[model samples]
Every structure is written in C-alpha cells, then in structure tokens.
Target: MKSKYKSIIYSIGVLLLTVGVLDKLWWLYICTIYTEFEECRVAYLSLFPERFQNAFLLTVIEILLLAVAAIIFSESKKAIYQKKASKILMIISLILFGWSVFSLM
Candidate 1:
C-alpha cells in the first residue's frame, strides 16, 4: 500500500483503539457502579453474544492491526518522530492487553 494510505489506516486504527478502550470503561462503569440496574448484569453485556462483545479476542485483533500500522508508518519516508510514536503505540497496546486480560477474569 502507498504511504498515504498506510498512514490513514494507522490513524483510523488508533481511533478505533480509542473507541474500544472507552467502550470497555463504559461497560465496567455500567456493571459495577450501576449495579442497581438489573439489565446491566444480564442482557446488556450479552446482548450481541460472545462473538460480538468478547474483549480478549477483540483486543488481540486490535493489537495485531496496530502492529501492522506501526510497521508501515515507520518504514515510510514521510514518517516523523517514528521512534516516539512506535514506543507510545507499544505502551498503549500493552496496557490495553493487560486490561483486557484482567477484564476476562
């Protein structure tokens, strides 16, 4: 893929990662803090079934896609501060993976 396209994909992947993290936080808050709501413990969490709401699987996919994006971004001549960006992405990926695992148990 062209550098521009690769950059765009990376950007979109970051946006998605943000959305996923926020969604998980919202889910946590809903189930924990809002325990008074019966639906929060029952239907809402499993409304779409495991295939759709499975955190561990989704986090794995995100991390893999982010790695691809980071590789493409670093290899591009137009890349700026590639090292810093790569480190930041790596840190975020690790944190996300840890959170995903913790959520599973």
Candidate 2:
C-alpha cells in the first residue's frame, strides 16, 4: 500500500484505540460525580486491581500497534511526515498510559 494510505489507516487506528480507552475511564470518573466521596473512593479502590489489569493490557496492545505502525511508516517515502505522526501518536499513548497508572494509586 502507498504511504499515504498506510499513514491514514494507522492514524485512524491509533485515534480509535486511544479514544476507546479514554472513554472507558471517562465513564468511571463520570460515575463519581453522583456518588458520595467515601463511596466513590471505596468503589474506585475495589475496582482498581481489575481496572489496572485491563489498562495494562490495553497499554501493551497500544505499544505493539504503535511499534508496527512506526515500522511501516519508516519504510515510507515521507520519512519526516511519518516521524512526526508517529511521535504524536507515541506522546498521546504515553499520556493515556500514565493516567491509567496514576489512577491506580
């Protein structure tokens, strides 16, 4: 496939993956708005272990996808463009992963 097409496909994939993970966590935070602080804290703590496991799995998948994307992009004619796009994807993925880890504490 052409680099242009590959880049677009990869970009959409990354965006969708990021949004899917964020949406899950966002709903959890949204739920806290209606609950008592103590209750919320208890619920969050109880769910932390399970949520962390899922988040870790998602993070690993994101890393693997990003690595594959990077490799594909590197072989493209537009090296600079690919580099920038990959960097942006990496940064976004890292931030999401960091947030997931922070929430565990």
Candidate 3:
C-alpha cells in the first residue's frame, strides 16, 4: 500500500483504539456516579478499603502504557511514510516516561 494510505489507516486505527480505551475509562468514572448496587460498580471499588492507593497508582500506570503503545504504533513503519516517526516517538516516550517517573518521586 502507499505510504499515505498506510499512514491514514494506521492513524484511524490508533484513534479508534484510543477512543475505546478512554471511553472505557470514562465509563468507570461514570459507574461510580450512577451505580447503587455494590456489585454493579467498577472493578476498583472492591479494593477501596484495602488498596485504594495501589489501585490508583496502577490505573495511572495503565494509562501511561496505553499512551506509549499508541505512540509506538503511530511511529511504526507501514509502507514508506513515518520515516522518522519511530525516532521521534522514542524520544518523546523516553522524555514523557522520565517526566512521569520524576513526578512520582
């Protein structure tokens, strides 16, 4: 396939995946607001009394990982475009990850 087409398709796929993930995350938040039955709530609710901090930390990590995966996919070769995309992605991911870890300190 042509590089231009490849880039477009990949971009759309990434965008869709990102949208799905974010929607699921939003649903989790919404569940907290809407649900009354304990069992109908989000997954993290069960851990509240014992592991709220850990759950919160893990959720952040999960979001970061999803972002990183999107970056990697967007940077990967499809045909001919994205020639420097991977390099740029590596730099950005490294910087962002570094900043995130630093913030956690």
Q: Ten consecutive residues with minimal summed lDDT in candidate 2?
A: 69-78
lDDT tens digits, residues 1-105, model 2?
555576686666566546646655755795767577666545544554665645446555555554454444444324555557666665655565555456556
lDDT of each: 0.58, 0.55, 0.53
Which tens-of-lDDT digit does each residue in 1-105 have in candidate 3?
455566675566456445435645654675676656444344445544555535347446645764654555555643435647645544544554554456455
Which rank order by TM-score, best down to worst? 1, 2, 3
- Measured by lDDT, the strongest candidate is 1
lDDT of 3 at 81: 51
lDDT at 69, model 1: 44
Clashing pairs in 3: none
In angstroms, give how far residue 65 of model 2 lies from its true place: 8.2
* Local accuracy of candidate 1 as per-residue lDDT tens digits, 52-104: 67545655665565455445444432455355675666566556756665655
Q: Which residues of candidate 3, in runs, are more than 4 Å off?
A: 1-59, 70-81
| Candidate order by decreasing lDDT | 1, 2, 3
Per-candidate count of clashing residue pairs (backbone under 3 Å): 0, 0, 0
Give each model a TM-score. Answer: 0.53, 0.41, 0.35
Q: Higher-TM-score candidate among 1 and 3? A: 1
Which structure is stronger by TM-score: 1 or 2? 1
Q: Which stretches of candidate 1 lie over 4 Å from their true place?
A: 36-39, 46-82
